[model samples]
Target: MKSYLAAAVQMTSKPDLEENLATASDLVELAVRRGAAFVTLPENFSFLGQETEKVKQASEIAHKSEKFLKTMAQRYQITIVGGGFPIPVGDGKVSNTALMIGKNGEELARYEKVHLFDVNLPDGNTYQESETVKAGVSLPPISISPELGKIGLSVCYDVRFPELYRQLSKQGAEVLLIPAAFTAYTGKDHWQVLLKARAIENTAYVIAPAQTGNHYARRTSHGHAMIIDPWGLILSDAGEDPGLALAEINPSRLEQVRRQMPVLNHRVFG
Candidate 1:
């Protein structure tokens, strides 16, 4: 009966940093009240307006928005995923980063998004993430103790690449975090399928928090923030709204699935 409760927070973030943080903080507080020991926010939870605005926010986020995350984690006495935000990395470019904060308000780990989104959609929208965001080089899976299990950190576009999840599973990842701002067109078509695939294939729990609704006139996200178990079962979903999805992470259930399937052990190709 021992289980860890986790929450995924969905949001429709605006261009205003203060407004976004306030909204996110309220959601996290709700999750904590619902018995969540680990809480996750969505991508661009601090700001989502124009590309230029993201670049500007990157330079100021460490002292401003990120500080808010640390304080919230401490106040709630819970671990938190700071979603994904842009951080300036010199050369006039930034890296889309996800941060983990401990219950004691200590910065645990940082994951910079490796796969940049450079695509043209059928909806006539295109994004060139590399134009302003630098890609990360490492692929190490981050782990924590009793609060959170071995965690694989990834951002929005990285969900398409199975190789990253495979590497993470190989490195002992029991929980996968995918914080995304997926376009409405693509997410409606592929989001659930991809999430279930990762969980079933890796035999790991998948926690995906997302940005929903229209941010500006042009950017609209498909938000079905969900938590999936090892057998590809959806535990909880926050459907197309700014809210929270709660689920229990049972370590024994994960072990049972792995024992039955053993997909990770049967892998032949890298």
Candidate 2:
């Protein structure tokens, strides 16, 4: 694989689909201007609002989000991993899907989020992701690009599941895209730690775009969009603000880490 710059964009996406799309486009343009060939936006980049509203507007969000990704990819001449968006699947529910598009506006990969976030937080935030999103059956898919290496796709809460990442790495994924709209409560303690663990264990570059700040109602997201190297180093971290984390994804560095520590080859179980 060839070396290139990748970007993880951080922004606050509201319930307004048009506004969020505009914001995401601007950030992608920013990354491209700064010489990033691969850029990923955070979860719910199209619309992050109340669950009821999301399901009601799932059709519109799906159409517009797909168009936005294609337009941005072709117009900017860069690959994009669109963060989780809602797609209608009947029965009054939607699937939280992550998409990867090539520079030519061709679809590269798609993964519906599997590990739904259903929990009661200590900060009084209870998430029932399964209530609205249909769980995916297949594992995360990987694309082996000549320039980008084997890139794997997964959405927000999937980061919490190491088995998913293990499967990806075993399937030859060199770079893992984990775009998220992580809640502030859990992210403060778990975000970076979890990402570092994934990178270290798999010896793969972890590119995670994230949502930051308040969206609506009692909802808030942690804003540290980050890029981690195979050596478990934090290459770039976009702080709690509307910005991006840009870093070089060098193949040599990845190889150096893997050769120095070959854990994936020694794994024993599924």
Candidate 3:
């Protein structure tokens, strides 16, 4: 019954970078006190403002936020999965990137958001992330630690694409990290279902941290950040507010579910 504690942090990030970072730090400390060895932050945990504002604050991949992540990991002495933040790549476009840092404050892995949100919502909201963001060319198959298990990394919109998850599982991913800032309109309808489906189908643990509440006049996120087991059971849910959801990732249980159903073994197509 090998297992380890993991946590998902939900937040209602604001336009202010320092304020948002402070909120995230508090939540991370809460998760740490709760005994989580692996903690994940929500998308845009450091800043969630207008597109122009995001670009203005964006730093190159190697600076600012990266240093913040390293320091946090070292201070906490735990693995930290940093959620998406803007990383400038020139030409007024940035990359929405996620990072995994080891307890020793070393970089473990990085995942750039491959899918950009370019939808016209029924609630009359339109987003064109492609305008200021560059899509990643590949998915990241990361393992923070041998005992922690191999991880599949993805961000908000990437959850809608199952092929990405499939590819990750194929590459030996046993845990999936989906840090998101899902809009209230669509999240209410699809968030939980999508999370469960991915876990059940992959027979893997799915940990999702999310942005909750309103960030601006035009933006609101549906919270309910959660951790789901391979059996598709909701081990923990953060509800519709800023908080932390904690759960244990049981590797033996994951193996049990996979052995019982064997869906991954029976897949006839890639």
Candidate 4:
């Protein structure tokens, strides 16, 4: 694996599919112009709204989101991760999926988000993702690229589960992609800490894109889109806005961190 720049794109995506796609296009251009070889869009980059609205438009959302990722990848000649869109499964259910596209617009890896966010917060915010999303039954997949190293994929809530990332690391993943739409309620106290812990424990680079600002009624995201090095250092942070967090993803640094603190190697159990 070689040294390259990766971007974590933060956006305030609403229910409008076309508008969100346009925004993503501009962000992708920004990343490409800044010399990023790999760029990631946050979960719900295509659409973020009521679950029923999302479900109602799942087919259209999936189609356009996939096309946009492919088109952007081919046009900019950069690898991209477009994620957590609603892909209609059956019986009014959709799989929250992420697709990694290569420079040539070829699909490299696809991961359906396994963990669902189902919680009731004291701040009067309640999320029951399982109501519409079908949980992935298997572990996430890793894409071993010649230029990008081993890239593992996961979505928003999956970051809360260390075992998910542990499985990725155990499968030889060197970089972890955790794109999210983290709520303001939890993100303030938990987002960066969780991200750092994942990087530190896995000994891998973590690229996390996020959704920031208000998307709809009473639904606001806590945004600090960031990239963390294998040593758990905050390389770049895009704080509370519609922008990007850019950083260097270096294999040498990953190797160095692993040499100094081989946490994965020292793991006691599954």
Error of 1 at 149 (Å): 1.5
lDDT of 4 by residue, 84-131 (tens): 799999999999999999999999999998889999999999899999
Candidate 2 per-residue C-alpha lDDT over 120-225 given as tens digits, one digit per residue, 9 for 90 to 100:
9999999999999999999999988999899999888999999999999989999999999999999999999999999999999999999999999989999999
Tell me model 3's lDDT, rounded to 2 decimals.
0.90
How do all models score by TM-score? 0.97, 0.99, 0.97, 0.99
Q: Local distance difference test, per candidate?
A: 0.89, 0.94, 0.90, 0.95
Q: lDDT tens digits, residues 170-267, model 3?
A: 98889999999999999999999999999999999999999999999889999999999999999999999799999999988998999999999999
Candidate 1: Cα lDDT at 93: 89
Q: Per-residue lDDT for 123-193 in model 1, tens only?
A: 99998999988999988457667557788889988999999999999888899999999999999889999
Q: Which residue segments of model 1 deviate by more than 4 Å? A: none
Question: Where in model 3 is the C-alpha error above 4 Å?
Answer: 60-62
Model with the higher lDDT, candidate 2 or 3 = 2
Q: Candidates 1 and 2: which is better by lDDT?
A: 2
Instruction: Spell out the clash pairs found in candidate 1.
Output: none
